[model samples]
Target: MRMTEAELAQYKRDGYIVFRGLFSPSEIAILRNETARLSAIEADTVIRERTGGVRSIFRVHEADGATRSAAFGALVRTPRVLEPTRQALGTGEVYVYHTKINTKPAIEGTVWMWHQDYGSWQRDGCPRPDMGTFALMLTDSSEMNGALYVVPGSHKRGRVEPYYDESTSYKFWAVPKRDVIEVLKQSPAPVPIVGPAGTCVLFHCNLLHASGHNLSAEDRWHIYISFNACANAPKFTEKSRPDWVVSRNTKPLPIGPDVLNSGTEAELVRATSPN
Candidate 1:
């Protein structure tokens, strides 16, 4: 469904909007099962946390030289996701950038440093900051389980300086701690995004956001589907990451209806597997 004017206004003012229960329980179950199956496999792209625990499984949609599941493709193209994207971008054309499922194990979950996703996109030569992510909850998220946190209206600051941290062995594209503190001084305190499975958050690419470590007894899982305005596709011919990491195809996604059914887990496993 298209976002209401009030929702659009809030996104303009706050850089994010939360939609509670956007997906049904059964729909969430389908995604959760798929995530579990994909994450168990060992792949170079499936990164681990700093402590060497499973971090996330990227590109769940595109697998085995084809789109993995009809349900996933439908979810990506659903008006529930695409309408808001088009409205927020002020453009009708949108293209898939990538998608990933972040799995944070209880007790051993690691923290994600505060960062704007656009910083990395800029490095990839995306001409404008017209990208955003729709983060859908696959498992319940609570403060005790490392829920995502965002600084209200931080996207207004646009892209900030980023540097590499050798200790983390990952490129740290987030702003400095002092800058974050300064922004916090002017903005409201970080808001923890906590909700049950089926909740979703749509945030601007340049929004300053992060999540703490999960310490609760249950695992926390969420999928991030990034979309960019077709007009803002990357300008560079060469890419630094794999196709799954950053899609080479810029085709606009076609909207479809929900495909959820009362299928057994085993049935879903076969349906979602490569043809």
Candidate 2:
């Protein structure tokens, strides 16, 4: 669905927005079924399982079964979410950079760290702001299962530095923490975007958001998908992110694919920042 003018304004000002009914009930039903099937057969098998040992997070990129989930692909390309993304980011064609399934079991899992997405992508050669992604809940999400926490206005702030030590506590990477807090000091109260299964939250690449751990018994399943608009998009280097990428680039640059990777816009914004 096209975003309302108010929603669009909020998106532009806050750098993100949460739409209540992202997926149809039938669609969500199918997703839950598929996820259950995947979970039952591959619970201990797919991707990164509880690295914290506390039981708050499960990274699903380590296994092929997780990599190729059909439900995930459908959600990423769904026009409801994609169209708004295109209008916000602007691109003829968009690419889903990667997909992440975060399963927060009720009694286990650690809290998601507080940091910025851009802290990592400050690499020499990588697509910066093509698009950053947020996940859609496949199951009801809450503090019991460590729902996501976001710093509402941080997306419009100055560049975020990497978290050297606590960085890894977030996703794949992060920058320093002191720098982030300094920027966040002027922000509003930390607000956790609330929603049920089938809801999608989209944020800007540099939006400073973080999620906490689930302290309850219910499982919180969220699927995150990264994407980028088709043009002005950094050319795909030979070796890049496996999720959404170019098979080939017509207008090539000096960098080769081995390193011109694709990641959330936060990475690109931080890395490419003139600062």
Number of the top lDDT candidate: 1
* Residue 26, model 2, lDDT: 67
By how many angstroms RMSD does model 1 differ from the true structure? 3.2
Error of 1 at 41 (Å): 1.3
Indicate the TM-score of model 2: 0.74
Clashes of each: 0, 30
Q: lDDT of all predictions, in order shown?
A: 0.80, 0.57
Candidate with the greatest TM-score versus the true structure: 1
* Candidate 1 TM-score, C-alpha based: 0.90
How many angstroms is residue 118 displaced in model 1 relative to the true structure, after the best TM-score fit?
Answer: 0.8
Cα lDDT of model 1 overall? 0.80
Cα TM-score per model: 0.90, 0.74
- Candidate 1, run of 10 with poorest lDDT: 163-172
